[model samples]
Target: MAMIEDAGRRRALRTLTAGALAAGGGLLSVRAFAGGLATVNMQLGWVPGGNQVGEVVAKRLGYYEKEGIDFHIQPGGPNIDGVAIVASGRFQTGEISSSPSIMLAVSEGLPIKCIAVGLQQHPYTFFSLKKAPIRSPQDMIGKRIGIQSTGMVLLRALLAKHKIPENQVKIVPIGADMMPLVAGQVDAVTGWQTNTTALKPLGADRVDLRLWDTGVRLYALPYYATTSMLKEHPETVQGFLRATARGWMYANQNRDQAIDMLVKDYPNLNRADERVAIDSLMHYAFDQTTQTQGWGAMDAAVWEEQIAMYGQLGQFRAAQPKVDDVMTLDVLKATHSSRLKV
Candidate 1:
C-alpha cells in the first residue's frame, strides 16, 4: 500500500513538472511572436504643434526605449489627412484630433478607437484683448472676429446655441500673431491661446475663455489605436499608453522646455507664438472633465451630442456615433496613478 501511494505521488509530481515546462515554453513563444522590429511605429497629425509633444519627448528622452517602443513619426499638417493611414492597417496607431477622429471614424466605417485623450478639453480657444471689456462669448455679439478657417464646425455650434445669427459676425483669416486684431483688422481673433501669447507683449492680455468660461466646451484630442492592434498586441498599446501618460505629465509641467524641444524639431516658425500654443495646448490638455476621471476620460454622451451638432451643420451624414462605438476607456488602465479619476 505504501509503495502504491508513493507511485501515485511521483506521477502527480511528473505531471506538474511537464505543465511548468509547457507554461515556460508558451511564454517564450509569445515573446517571439511579438510583431517584428525592435520598435513600434505611430503617425502624428502635425509636425510640431503642442499636440505632438508627448510623443516627441518620449522619443527624445528614450522613454519609448524603456517601454520597448520604436517610434516612426510621420508628421503631417493641421490640414494633412491621416485617417486612411491610420485606418487602413498601414500603421498600428496614430493620433487625429479626438472629436474629428471620433466623427470621421464613425462616418467612414473605420476601426479606430480613441484609447487615450491627452488634454481635458478642446484646445481651440478664443481670445480678446484684456482692455476690450469683453467678458464672455455672449459679450461678442455683432463683433468682428478673426478666424483661421470658416470650415470650423464648433464655432458654428456655439453660434447656433447662443442664438447668434451667422450673419451678425464678420470673419477674417488671421495669423499666429493676432495680426488682424492687433492692426484693428478685426475685433478679436479665434486663434489658439498659444498663438495669441505674443499679444501680451503687444499691449493686450488674453483669456482662455474655454477654461475661464463655458463657451466651447469641447473635449481634448486623444491618442488612438486600431481594433486589430488592440486585440492582437494589447501589451504594445498598453506600453505606449504608459509611456504617453508620463509624456503628457512631462509636457504639462515642463512648458518652456517642451516648447524649446518642439522648436528644436520645428524651427523658422514663430517660437514665442508657438510657446503660447504649447502652453494653451497643455492648459486644455488637462481639464476638469479629464481631472475628474483618468487622463483620457471621455463621456460618450458629450461626444455623440457634439457629433449631432456637426451633423446638423452638415459635417456628417450619419447618425451620431454611439459613445462606446467611437471611443473606449480601457487604455486608462495603463496608468498607475491612483489619482486618475476615471
Candidate 2:
C-alpha cells in the first residue's frame, strides 16, 4: 500500500469541519473558493523530491497561475497524515506514493477518489547482486528477502501471485537502507528504481525484478481529491490536470532545463542526483498509452485488476471496494484536449 517511511501511521477518518462548509442559499455547501482564484493546496504522502518535478515545473513556469489556481504543496513526512488532512477538507487535493493506498482508504470509508495516475507502471522492485540474483519470483525461494514492514503486504502479494508458499522464503524486516544487502545480511532488498542516489551503492552488479513483472500490477504516484470537491467543482480539477500535464510534457522534452527548474524550486535537492533520477522517472510517467491518450492517462481495467488482486490478498478491512469507489475518469475526459499530447 503506502511505500513511504510513515506507512505505519493509522488512517483515521477525519470529518469535514464548519470552516470547509460554505453557506449558499441558506444551505451549507462545499465550494471551491469564496472569491478570486481558487487555491489548490496539494498534500503529499512523502517529502517532495524528484517525484514532484512536474508539479514544480508547472508552479515555476506559472502554468497553475495561468489556470487561475493559487497552487501550493504541503510536504508530508513520518509525522504527517496527508490523506486524513485532505479528507478533512483542509486541502483541496493529494498525491500518494502508491495506488492501493487509495483503495484501502476507500474500503475503510475515506471520502477520497483517485483522479489521475502519474506513473503508468509501478517502479517498486527487488534488487540483488548478480552473484546471488533474484531474477524472478521463483528465485526468492529459500533466500533472505529484506523489506520494510509496511511493504510486507506487497511481498505477500508477490508470493501469492506466483503461487509460492510464504513459508518457502525468509522475510527480514529492514528499514529503507540498502546496506542489508551490501553487508550480506539479506540476499535482496526492495526499493523504487527511480531512487538513483540510494541504488548507487549497489553498483553495476545489481539485478532488478520489478513487482509489476511478477503480475502484482500496482500504480505509483496517483493524484486524488475529496469526493465533495470532485462533485462540486470538477472544472477546478480539470484545470489542475491540464496544467500539470503540460509540465510533464515539457519535462519529457527538456530534461536538462526541467532538472534545473526542479532543483531551483527545492534548493536542498542535488542537481546531479535528480538529473539522473528524472531519466528513470520519465520512463514510468510516459508510455504507449500516454502517447495516444495524452499525459495523466489511466485505464479502468488496470484499476479493476488492482482491486481484484488486493481483495484476493485480504488487504481490505471491510468489504472490497468497487473501482468506481476508488477512482473516476471524468476529469481526465474533460481535460483530454488540454492535456499535452506526447
Candidate 3:
C-alpha cells in the first residue's frame, strides 16, 4: 500500500512523451456527451497480474471506445467463482482459469467458449519453509500442501503430474492468504506473487518454486465467452478483442508507465514489493503466445491432455468436449489488431 513515488510519475511522463496518442486514438471520439450507451460488465479474478493487465490497459487507453464496446471494470471477490459468474450472466466479459472449467462446462450444456488465453506460462509456485528440507516437486510427496481451493486448477494439475494421490497428501484451502505457511499452520502454500506481495507487511519471507516448472505443460488463464454472445453481436466482440489486443501491446510496450498508474490508482496495492508481481509478467509478452496465435490460440494436444487429466481425477463424470471446437480463432484473425499471423 505504499504510495507511488514522484519518481514514478516522472517516469510515466517521460514514457508518454514518446507517443502523444495511442495507436487507435481516433476510435474514442463520437457516441458520447450523451446517453444510450451499450453496457458491458467485465469481471476480475482474485489477483491482478498478467490476467488483469489487458482490461486495465484497455480501460486506460480507451481501446474499448475504439472498438465501440463500452466497458465497466468490476473487481472480483475472494470466494466468487469466475466461471459461475460468467455462466450466470453476471458479466458479459471476464477471464478465468482453464483446467476443470471449459470441458466441464461444455458437457453441462453451458454456452461458454475460451476466447483468448492470457498467461502463456503460469505463475503459481509451491513454497516451503527454508528449513523444511524441501527442494523440488518430488519433495512434496506425503506432505500437507496449502492451496486456495480443493478443485483449484494449479493444485490439481500438480497432483496429477506428480502421480500423487490426494489420499497421501492433505490439501488445505488457504484462500488467497499465505501467512499461515509462515506461522507453520501449513507446510507449503499455493499462491502467486500478488498474494505474497501482500504478505510482505506480515514479515513472511518465503521462496516460490514455480509449480508449472515440473512436467505440467498447459495453458493457465483463458478468456471465455458464450456462443449466444458471439452470435448476437460479433462486431462488438471483435472490437473488444481488438482493443484488448492493443491494450496488451501498449501495456507490454510501456510497463513502468502502466505500473505507476496501477499503484497510483490502487493505493492499497503493496508498492514496495510489487516488483516481483510486476517483473514476473515479463515472460508473457506480445510474441510468445499472442503473436504466435493472434492473442487467444491453444494447442489441441495441450487442451485434450488437460481435459483427459480432469477426467482421470474424477473432476468430471463424463468425457469433456472437443476443445478445438469450443475455442475459435475467427474473431481474433478478423480483427487483425496487428499484422501477426496465427
Candidate 4:
C-alpha cells in the first residue's frame, strides 16, 4: 500500500517538475514527424491494461499506419513521469488517469493542453459491502472511507458537493485494493469501477458510489500534448485522434477481436480478467453522448465545472486556468465527420 501511494506521489512530483520547468524556463519543441511517417509516442500515466484496449486494437489492425502515424505506446510506471516526458518534448503525447491532472498541470503553467477525452465520464468510484452499504455521498457520513492519500481531493469534492461535514466521515489511508475493506479495516474503498480484476475480491456484496454521479463530473483518460505541438502541427493531432477514434469504434463493435489483439500485444495481462473488464471499461468509454458526438467527445462546459470545483477545493495554488487553457476542442471539431461515423 505504501509503495503504491509513494508511486503516485512520485508521479505527481514529476508532473509538478515539468510544470515548474515550463513556467520558469521553457520546454523543448520536438518535431511532429519522423522520416516519412508522423511518429507519436503516447505516454500513459500507469501500466498499460484494459484501459488501452482501443489503442492496442488500433495498432494491431494497422489503423495508425494507415493514418500515416508510427504510433508507440510508452507504458508509465511509478518511476516514469509520463506528463513530464511529454512536457519535455521527449514524447509526442500523453494520457493521464483523470481530468484534474490536466487542470492542475495547466494551472502551474505547464506547456500542454488536453485535446480529447477517452472516457466521457470518470469511472472512479467508492466501493463498499452490501452489509454496510455506502450507495451515496450522504451514506459516507460516519463510515470509515479507505482511499489513497492522493485521492483525498476526490473525497473532499464528494463531501463538499453533498454538504457533508468533513469531520463526519473518517478517512482511512489505504492502497488501491479491496483488502482493507474486506478485513473490516474500513467500511469502503476507492478505485475505478472498470477494473474488474481489482473489484473481484469484493464479490457480489460490492456497492458502488461513483464520483461523477455525485455531481463532481470529471473526464478520465484525457489525451494531452504540448502547446507547441498544437500550434505547430494541428494536422498531426487530428490524424492521431481520427485513427484512435476508429480504434475505439472497432473495439466497441467487435469485442472478441479487440480482446485478442489486446492480450496478444501485452502478454502479461490475464485474458479472462481483461475480457470481463472490457465490458465495464467500454460502458464508460461510449455512452449516449458518444453515440451522437462520437468517441473522445468532451464538453467545454464540463471542463469549466471541474475547474470551478477544483478551485473551490483550493487545488490550484497558481492562477486558476481557464477552460480553454486546459483543453481545446479544435481537434475534435476538425475530425467531427469521421468521429461521428465512429
Number of the predicted model whose TM-score against the real structure is largest: 2
**Which structure is stronger by TM-score: 1 or 4?**
4
Model 2: per-residue Cα lDDT over 1-342, one tens digit each: 423222233424323344345422211122455356778989999999999989988988989888888788899987677887787678889999999889888887778999999999999999999999999999999999999987898998899888999999999989998999999999999999999999999999999999999998889999999898898878888888888998898898899999999988899999999999999999999998888788888889899998998888778767899999999999998988877552
Model 3 lowest lDDT segment of ten: 1-10
RMSD (Å) per prediction? 15.6, 3.2, 11.9, 4.0
TM-score of each: 0.75, 0.92, 0.75, 0.91
The clash number for model 3 is 1
Instruction: Encode model 1's per-residue lDDT on 113-157: one tens digit a residue.
Output: 878776665656666666664466676677776765533455677
Decide which is better by lDDT, 1 or 2: 2
Off by over 4 Å in 2: 1-12, 15-35
CA lDDT of each prediction against the hidden true structure: 0.61, 0.86, 0.60, 0.85
- The candidate 2 region of ten consecutive residues with least summed lDDT is 22-31
Q: Using alpha carbons, what is the TM-score of model 4?
A: 0.91
What's model 4's overall lDDT? 0.85
